[model samples]
Target: MSRLKLPHNPKLLSHWEGWENATVYSTEGNSVLVQTVDMITPILDDPYDFGQVVAANAISDIYTMGCLPELALNIIAFPCSVLPKVVLSQILAGGQDKAEEAGVLIGGGHTVEDDELKYGMVVTGFGTKDNLWRVGGAKNGDVLILTKPIGTGIISTALKAGEATLETINIVAESMKKLNNLPVLLKNHKIKINACTDVTGFGLMVHALSLINKSKLGIKIVAREIPIFKKANELALSGFVPGGAYRNQEWASPRVIINATPAKMPFDPILLFDPQTSGGLLVAVEEKNAELLLNILKEAGFSATSIIGSLVVDKEERIEII
Candidate 1:
């Protein structure tokens, strides 16, 4: 839908490609500049939990990019009429608590009467450019790692439809709330990760495309290597997958090819593109120290981590899932 037509009269943009051109970057305290904003309509049944997850997710980019945030501003939009003030308050409180846990300030933000609820934070942090992890450096022989299990989109969709189990919601929320802090932990590791990014709305496939597009590489994943939530695959096959998954496949179709027979893993491709509210980080690291990096991530609390794939130079410019 987005690719075929403008959501509305598309406005002209001025800050086009700001991130791609910046170079010679430096920061106070020798930090690499990292900025990230995250928000989503209130997804959790518990308003407080919603707030906490949104705030933590918004700041995840700083963690993924290898920096400690100095501060952040809240970004939110919601329907006050549809939602009670108490619900709203719980959301804010939860957001504030998440920020406090991360030792960053939410400070303040804007709100509007939106049809749907949305909440998140904008985080600005700093780190050395030398430590900046990017998705363009994925080299052949680099091992790919997923810091958390996939399937937040599917589980949440089921929740919205009143079809998801409480156990599933609890499990998915735990994964979403888990922040990706491997950057700081990987600072002194022997592992050499070539590319990295937080897997969110674009799903593992679309985000991986960014790396393949820039590095002229294709990614290969072992079906058994990719980690998934306990019942996520089950839900997806039961037709509980989210809309974002379809959108992802539609937008990134040219770049991805799923090799598994549809019979073996029916919703695998859909899962690859499902929009994750607060998904995990994917890093392409050299195999020599892949274990060490995974160890550090585990120490940092990414317990479900796994080496999912490898990158290969490809003139075709795509993701080859095997």
Candidate 2:
């Protein structure tokens, strides 16, 4: 993005300066329009499941910005000569179902023939200017919360190696298909969220660094408090780690500091750097409202949600993992 000579638009909001998604104020200045596009190839065997996960992943960017998805356009690539037409239909059906679940309409899209199959979406949504959530609003006394467990990258590597059990594959698939819809929960409980972002191609550490860096503060994470998928640690230890995990670690090496590690931990610290697909939202809320927000998420069936860490006034380093 830095290399590109992008135009200067006065309507662009500064709050979304470093955010992955882009938001602009409407001409009327009453609401803000949020827009984002994402795409990913098949991670699982079932085309339907792959479509569901990809759709969820693409739409998550809007949710991370605290906006409700309203419209989407399908982005597809497939080899018509190699794969049967029915496969494409099932994939579209799956995407449609998931989009509808998020109250978004698939108005139209573009498709093309390619050697390998791929699918995703471009989603748009709207929210009031006053309610816009930025990634830079975390305060010194804010508490960090993650809505989903990590390790999709590890589990995916295991599946490709034919070492993952059917049960494990099922569990990971469901997690990836889950949507990061915290705005609904927050509104229901009348809670105000300070900062938020979804964990995706970038691992938790990288995303956490993005949060604190924007706020010009530091954070301390409780390594053990972080939620992990079943058997993810074991799989990661067995050399099932993805290439993206290594890249993430290398990119965050200079900014992250390891304070301590528990003696009984199963996985190495590298697991903290594992990449994720359709991952959960990392939210920062005032310390006083942290517990109540967590309980609300739990009651709404977000079992993996937990208070992983807190922001500190010290800006010595972007993150400290203990």
Candidate 3:
């Protein structure tokens, strides 16, 4: 949609800004509002778990913008006739619980009868005029840190095909349920983040590419340094890759330069383009602050966080996989 020549307004700070969070000036106030709407079908068999995951996914955009998520409205499409009311209640309860955990309020929402069930929220967050973050803020020699591991897409496909183990499902579920709350956690540390974005449907490759698209900087990703789920690599080797992974690879291959051989990477190269659900934040910080920021993230219980790559200048390719 960013490629589309859509209408634009001066108050829209993030218009046509790829898949980054949207920021707009308040019509009646000086504050900037970060908002996004997202929905997803059931990934987990339990309705409650599905609700929690989707809610986290919905509000993640606000966190990506370095804002506090304060308000949300539930969006539900359910088969009322097919499922009992208790199922619906459980789903709503799950969403409400997750919202409370994120310090957000579910004031109200809209629901419509449908044959298939879908759930999500429209999240609104706030930040000061001077603190808004953008995908294009990466600078030369900036360190790139990923907050969570990749490979959920492949594992999800495996689960659907009955090729995944119970342990794998639980591992991926825990990762998906984890909130990307680094923005809120950073207030105490006072670290300066140069760029930020949540890895989602576009996968890490496309999301990282967005960071340098508007600048002269290029990214060098250390394949071995990247973190992955315990069973994701083995599953990918067995042909459990998702359709989105193939699409992401096809879209990102031309722009990225791959330097590492398949033998050197612990996981399949396709996993680099595996789409994630409620994934972690990919942040760019100055080299001096990189270790400090990484420590802060780990202290906040983001154990999977790792320094995966760095941003560079005077490079012809948009991204280089080393």
Candidate 4:
């Protein structure tokens, strides 16, 4: 599969890491901004309903960077013969509703006829005047905190296949539907976060790798202490993992060692690498105030947040998964 032919271009190779959205490149202080547009025919059947959820997914990167939205654009690819304009309108309505909830305005976008149905958004936002929490900011001894439960990747795949229960599906749905709203809570707190990144397609390790490389440090994680969504383990056992996870494993494996045995692994490494549409904020905060920040997140209703690990020392960015 490594030799599998796929899209090949320097732009894709250079920005393959999620940082394309948050990194800046320029002179004259006119910093570049991050904006993205993505659509999934895989989730097409529920387009009208999933539009809102997916809209949020597209906006999440902006939120993770503490940026406020300025505008949005709708993108669509649908089979004109098979799907009606009415269906497309309803999908737009759903996306509009979610965009408004996030306090963003939808401008205009493009649409084209295709063999399958696809839908998503393009979101643009402004950065904080003096701050941008790039992964490089993470410092040694800082504590790691994750805001949402893991395993939504497995849960979503399960739902698509009708293998998950209403309760399990609902739990995953709620986690996905929630807007994170971390900025509201974070703005009110006096404490500062050294680094922050959203855990998406890369899973925990890939995202953590960015923080590690930027800071030049090693991480010690207590796998048992990490917070995972209900039934995540169950889904992992069933092998309902998404494909993006394997890519992440390949990228992150060299920097880390699986401290736990395969049998003892909390979730499938494949599932761990699954691509998340919109996931939780992975925050690295100063040790002295990590607890205070957790309490703030707790008060804001993200009770699942936890202190899963800490930067141990400057040692080639090795990870002890357990």
Q: Residue-wise lDDT of candidate 4 within 82-138, one digit each (tens)?
A: 977888888888788888888889998888999977887888766543555565677
Model 3 bad stretches (over 4 Å): 1-5, 26-30, 314-317
Clashes of each: 6, 0, 0, 3
Candidates 1 and 4 compared by TM-score, better number: 1
Clash count, predicted structure 1: 6
Model 1 Cα displacement at 269 (Å)?
2.9
Best-to-worst ranking by lDDT: 3, 2, 1, 4
Give the per-residue lDDT digits (tens) of candidate 3, residues 1-322.
Answer: 6577865876777764465666555543567887889988787777787788988898888898888899999999999999999999999998889889999999999999999999989999988667777777888888999999998888889988998889888888888888898888888776888899999988999999988886878899899888898889899999999889999999998888889887766668898899999999999999999889888889888898999999988456488888
CA lDDT of every candidate: 0.75, 0.85, 0.86, 0.72
Q: Candidate 1 on 1-322: residue-level lDDT in tens?
A: 3356422321211111322211223445544555666668767798888888887778777776656666888877878889888888888898888778777877788888888888877777766766666657778888889988888888888898898899989988888877666655665665665777788877878877777765667788776777888888878888987777898889988877777776645445678777887788888888987888888878787888999888777878777776
Q: Which one wins by TM-score: 2 or 4?
A: 2
TM, every model: 0.87, 0.95, 0.95, 0.85
Question: At residue 5, what lDDT does model 1 achieve?
Answer: 41
lDDT of 1 at 9: 22
Cα lDDT of model 2 by residue, 1-322, tens digit: 5676665677766433465444544555668788888888788888888888988998888888778889999999999999999999999998999999989899999999999998989999888777777776888879999999999999999999998999999988998998777886677676678888888888999988878774668998888789999989899889999999999999997888887756634467777889999998999999999889989889877899989999997656478877
lDDT for 294 in candidate 4 is 88
Tell me which residue pairs clash in candidate 1: 31-127, 31-128, 32-126, 32-127, 32-128, 41-117
